[model samples]
Target: MAELTLLQAINKALEQQMEKDKSVVVFGEDAGFEGGVFRVTAGLQKKFGEDRVFDTPIAEAAIVGNAIGMAINGLKPVAEIQFSGFMFPGYNQIVTHAARMRNRSRGKYGVPMVVRMPYGGGLRALEHHSESLETLFAHIPGLKLVIPSTPYDAKGLMIAAIQDPDPVIFMEPKRIYRAFKQEVPDQEYKVEIGKARVVKKGEGMTVVAWGAMMRETQKALKRLEKENIDVELIDLRTIAPLDYDTVLESVKKTGRLLVVSEQVKSLGIASELITRANEEAFLYLEAPPMRVTGHDITVPLPKGEHHHMVDEKRIAHTIKKLANYEV
Candidate 1:
């Protein structure tokens, strides 16, 4: 095992996949020469050569559209949309073409492509550089959604997404790219899609969250423990086809739930999880499922993000209310 940053792990995964599969190709804005705006793809173009890894024009629509064509033609294309917000330019192609192609052709055609984007906030980034839109893609049918919270998950899930036989939207918690280092196997390895990781276990309320929010959750858990709250924290690594069993089981044991995230509360992933708990684990609840999420408004400028974003205080407040107050 070797310690690697989230960015390093992703680079290793792409490097290994390119070596293992001749059909695997990577392309996107700055993906070739500059290694991407975040340097996630740095040195890949030089190592893999221009043919297998090359740069493309600054066009999300063109990038995604061509990836769909490549997948249909039997090539595994890993395309990058500079950021989560830029993905909308390619939304129609993803939903109507890449997503529906396999079902429309009745299995005659498919796009085994991975659309990667650096997502989430707390990076002090400008507009369009920070957005958590996993819920939007998860709501659409025919697309697989994977969000990696750690270096290990980032590397393993990227490999799996590349090899999946359908379109996949891979969201990375940009804020945690270098947050810490962890031992990630150097050899080939993969984590299955739609699976959640139980990061920490306890018997009190279950704090369910994913991506960048996982960091804040960890901090909040520490604070709660000081108050004698033994919270079980669940890192929901995947959003769509959620690991409902893992989360529901935790909810059952704790008899309370708090879903946290940095996305807007309106029609967000937190809302979906709350609905799921209601439908599947309503009776087991000691308190109504609560969500500590960003407000339903445009992401604020740097100075005001802290006010709108979820933090340790917000999480502790929810935990206290659920543990001490009436449902």
Candidate 2:
């Protein structure tokens, strides 16, 4: 095992996969020769050769359309969009085709491809660079959405995504790409998709988060430790086809729920979590389920981002409020 940042872990996963499987091809805007905007795909082209790893034009639709064609024809194409917000051009192809290919063919075909993009704020990027529109992809049926906050999960989940028979939307958290490092095994591994990881155990409430928010949530949890607010923390690794079983069990045990996400509050993953808690663990709840999420507006310009970003203070405040609330 070696200490690797989240960015390097992704590169490791891609390199290992490309080496193990001849069907895996990687490409995107500047992803090949330049190694991506964040260099998360750094060094892949050099190792795999241009034939297996290369760059594409600035057309997002063409990128995804090309990926879909490669996938159904038996190639596991790992395509990249510079940023998740810029995936709109390719969004149509993903939702309408990549997502429907399996069901349309009645199991005759499956799009064994992974579409990777860096999403979420804290990077203070432009309008189309930092949006965390996970609910969009998570809403689609055939696609699996994944976000990783650590190097270990980034490597494991990415390998799993590449090996998945169906389409997967692998959203990397730009804020934490190089924010931290961890000792990730220097070997190919897979973190089972649709399974949630229990980060910490507590008796007060269930706190669910993923991606960069996981870092901030952990910080808040530490502060609450002084207050003796025991809280269970869950990392929602896979967004779609959520691991509700783990979450529901936690809610039933803790008697409270708090979902934290970077997307807008309306119909977001937080809403879905609360709804599930209400339906499955209603009687166990000591307090109504709550969430601390981003506002329902465009992630503002860099200057106004602090007002929009969810930090430890905001999370800690909400956790304390929910943990201490008397129903």
Candidate 3:
């Protein structure tokens, strides 16, 4: 095992995958020479050379579209969209081409590619730099969405995403890039894409979240422990095909649910989880699951965004309701 930061783990995974598979090619704005704005792809350009690890023009459409072309031609391309918000320009390509390629061709063609983007709030970052748009991607049939909350998961999930036969949108929580250190396996290991990880176990309530909101969920758990609330924290590492079995087991044991996420409340990933619970574990629930998420509004700037985002106060309130429910 080796101790590494979240960003460092991502870098190591990309390096390892590139070394192992010659089909894997990397490209993005500044990814080649500058090592990317976050330096997640740092030093790869020199190691892999310009042809395999080079930069493209400042165009998201070209970047993603070209990746689709390369994938059809039997090359595994890893394209980085500088920011979550900046990915809109290439959304059409993702939804139309990359996603539908396999189905449209009836397995004759496959876009085994990874689209990496930094997402979520709580970095005091520039406007539009942190949007939790995982729900939108999950709604699309052909795309797989992944969110890594820690250094270990980041490395493993990245490897898995790269190797997935389908296209994957790999969302990284930017806030925890350097938050803490974790021991990642020195050799290759892949975290399954559609899996959930139980970060903490408890019997009182199950607190579900992904990406940066996960940090807030952990803080809420610590605060609730003072009140004798043994909360279970489920890091939903993947959104598209959520790990419903884990969620079902946790909710069935706790009989309560509090979902936290950086995305807005309207039609977000939490809503999907709540709907799934109603369909599968409605009888086991002591109280109706509640979502504590960003307000259904535009992503705010730094000064006022904190007010709009969900935090421990909202999570605690939800848990209290569950604990004190009469019905």
On lDDT, the candidate that comes out on top is: 2
Residue-wise lDDT of candidate 2 within 137-167, one digit each (tens)? 9999999999988899999999999999999
Report the C-alpha lDDT of model 1 over 205-249, residue by residue, as the tens digit.
Answer: 888989888888888777776688878889888887789999999
Q: What range of 10 consecutive residues in model 1 has the weakest lDDT sum? A: 318-327
Q: Where in model 1 is the C-alpha error above 4 Å?
A: none
Per-residue lDDT tens digits of candidate 3, residues 79-145?
9999989998889899989999999999999999999998878777898886888877999998999
* TM-score, cand. 1: 0.98
Give all TM-scores, in the order shown.
0.98, 0.99, 0.97
If ranked by TM-score, best first, what sequence of candidates would result? 2, 1, 3
In candidate 3, list every pair of residues with a backbone clash. Answer: none
Top candidate (TM-score): 2
| Candidate 3 residue-wise lDDT at 60 | 95
Report the alpha-carbon TM-score of model 3 versus the true structure.
0.97
